[model samples]
Target: MNEEDLSVLDTVDILDSPLDAIELSEPDSATSPPDPEEMLLLLEHPESTQRIVAARAFCELKDERAIPHLINLLQDVCPLTRVSAAYALGRNPSPVALAPLISLLQQDWNGYVRKGVVWALGNSQDTLALKPLIKALKTDISAVRLWSASSIVQIAQLEYESVVSAIPPLIEALRRDAIAPVRSNCAWAVGQLCRELPLNVVYATAIDALIEALAEDQDLGVKEDAKLALLRVGDPRGLKMIEELEQEGWI
Candidate 1:
C-alpha cells in the first residue's frame, strides 16, 4: 500500500482501458475517503476493480473485520485483486492469514502477488515464516528477495533461535546476490540480527561478511550499507578494519 506496492494506476489498469477514456479531476475540498463499512461490502463486489479498491482501502484503514474477506480475495481470479488483498493482509496481519499467504506465495505465478505475500508474512513475525522467507530470499526474483531480506529481519525480532537460523542465509545473500538492493537489505538484516545475537561463531561470521562486503563489493550502495552495519554493531574488529580502510582511503 506504500511506495513498495503496485501504484494505484497500475492496479486500476487491470482491463487495459483505452487512453482516451481516462481523465484527470481536481480533488473536492470536502470529499472524504469512502466509509470503511461500505468499502468492506465492496470486498465481495462482482467487478474485480471494486474488490481491488476495497482491499487496497484496508491497507490504510486496517479493520480486523476485513480479515476473512481479504483472505477470500487471496483466491480471486484477478492477480491485482489477489495482490491487493495480500497487501491489505500485510497491514492487518491477522494470525489466521499467514497460512493462506504462505500457500499463495508458494503457488502464485505472479511475482507481484508473491512479493505482497512475503511482505504480509514478515508482518506476521511468526517463526513459521522463517523457512519459506529464507527460501524466497534464496530463490525468488530480486524484488521478492529484497522484501524477504527485510521480512527476515522483522521475524528476527521474536526469537534468538530463529535469529541464529536466519543469519546464515542473509550472510550468504549479502556476499552473493547480484542485486545491490537485496545485498543492502541483507546487510541491514545481518546487522539487526547481530545486535540480538550473543557472542558466538555465528556472530563472528556475520561480522566478517559485513567487513568483506565493505572491502570488496562492487556496488557502493552495498558497501555503504555494510559499512553502516559494521558501524551499528560496533564490533572492535569491524571498527578497526573500517579505520584502517579509511586511513588507506579505501572506505
Candidate 2:
C-alpha cells in the first residue's frame, strides 16, 4: 500500500478499536461531587448498588436538604441500602433523622442494619436517643448490645443526665449479660455516665454495682473495665481491688 493509504488505514484501525481499550483524559477540574438532587434520584434507582452509592454521597455532602430522602432509604428493601441510609442520616446530624434512626434500630430485623442505626444514634449525640439505646443494650443480639453500650457512652459524654436512666440498664448488663464484651462495654459506660458527677452526687446503686463487678465478674476484661469505671467515679474500693489484683497477678 502507498504511504498515504497506510496512514489512512492506521487511523481507521484506531477508530475501530473497542471503546474499553481507550484511556479517557481526566477533566480539567476534579469531577464535581454529585449534586444532591442527582444523589436523591440514585437512591430510587432499582439497583441496590446505585442506591448505596447515592446514600454514601449524601453522607459525604452532609447536606441537611438530603436528610428526608436519606431517611426514606432506611426502609429500602436492600439491607445495604438501609445501612448506608442509616449511616448518612447519622452523619448528617439533624434532629429530624434521630426519631427515624431510633425506629430503625428497634424495628429492623437485620443485625447489620441495626448495627448501622446504633452507630448513627451514637454519632447523633441526641438525648432523645437515650431511652431507645438503653433498651437496645438488653437486646438478644450481642452486636446490638455492644453498639448500644457505646452509643450510651457517647450520649453520656455529651450530657450525663440524659443517660442517667441508662445507669440501671448498664448495671444489669454488667451483672447479667451473657456476652463478655457486652458486660465489659457496660462497665465502661457506667464509668462514663458518672465521670462528670461529684463523688457524693454519683448514684450509689451504680457505684455499688461497679464495685461488685470488679470483685466478682468472671471475665478478666470485665473486671478491668469495672475497676477503671470505679476509679473514674472516685470509688476507693476500685483502687483497693486493683492493688489486690496486682498483688495476685490477676490484673
Candidate 3:
C-alpha cells in the first residue's frame, strides 16, 4: 500500500481495541494505556528512522495523552522526525495540543511539516483552527496552499459556522493575489464557503473579484480559478471577460 494507506493502517483498530498489554506478559483491559517508557524508547532511539518508527507507534496507538511530548519533537533537526512528530500528535489530538498545533500551522515553513499540520487539523476537526488554516491557504507553496484548502473543506463540512467567515477573505485573495497557488486555494475556499453560506451578498461581492481576476490576473491557475468562480456566481460580466481573455490567447 501507499504511504497514505500505511498511515490509515497505522490508525486502524486503535480506539476500539484493547490497549497493548503494559508489560506484555500480564493482561489488562483493552483501555489500558501503554507504558510511557516504551513510547519514549521509540522516540529516543539513536537513529532518526527509529524515532519515526516510535512516532508512528504512538499514532497507531491513538493515545490522546501523548500529544505534548510528540509536539516537542516538531523542532527535531531530522526532517523525518519532525514530520513524524506532527503526524503522531495530529492523530492523537487532545485539548492541550490544539493551540500549539494552530501556532505551528502559522509558523512552520517546511512543506512536510505544514502538510502534517493540515492533516492533523483535519483529524482534530477543531473549529478554532479555521482562521489559521484560512491564512495558510494563502501560502506561496502549492502543496501547502492546496492542503490548507482541503483542510478548510473538511472543517467546513464538520462545523460550518467558524469556517463560513472565510469566504470574503478568500474572494479578496482570489481577486488580488499574485501567487497562483494561493489564488487557487482562494477559489476552492470560495466554493467551500458557498456551500455553507450562499448569501447573495457574498456572490455579488465575489463576482466583482472574479471579474477583475479574469480581466487582469496574469497567472493561468488564478485566471482559471477566477473563471470557475465566475461560473458559480453566474456573472455575465465575468463570462465576457473570460471570452475576451480567450480571444487574446491569454487563457
The clash count for each model shown is 0, 0, 2
What are the per-residue Cα lDDT tens digits for candidate 1 across 1-251? Answer: 33444333233223121211111123345877558999999999999999988987777676899999999999999988898888888878888998999999999877777878888899887889989999999988777788899899998769999999999999999999977778988999999999998899999999999999999999988989999998999999999999999999987
The prediction achieving the highest TM-score against the true structure is 1
lDDT of 2: 0.75
Residue 172 of model 3 has an lDDT of: 62
TM-score: the better of candidates 2 and 3: 2
Q: Which stretches of candidate 1 lie over 4 Å from their true place?
A: 1-33
Q: lDDT, candidate 2, residue 50?
A: 93
Model 2, residue 249: distance off in Å is: 3.5
Model 2 C-alpha RMSD to native = 16.1
Q: Against the true structure, candidate 3 has what lDDT?
A: 0.64
Model 3: worst 10 consecutive residues (lDDT sum): 15-24
lDDT per residue (tens digit) for residues 144-184 in model 2? 67768988888766765665667788889999997787788
For each candidate, the alpha-carbon lDDT, in order, equals 0.84, 0.75, 0.64
**In model 2, which regions exceed 4 Å deviation?**
1-38, 157-160, 231-234
Decreasing lDDT order of the candidates = 1, 2, 3
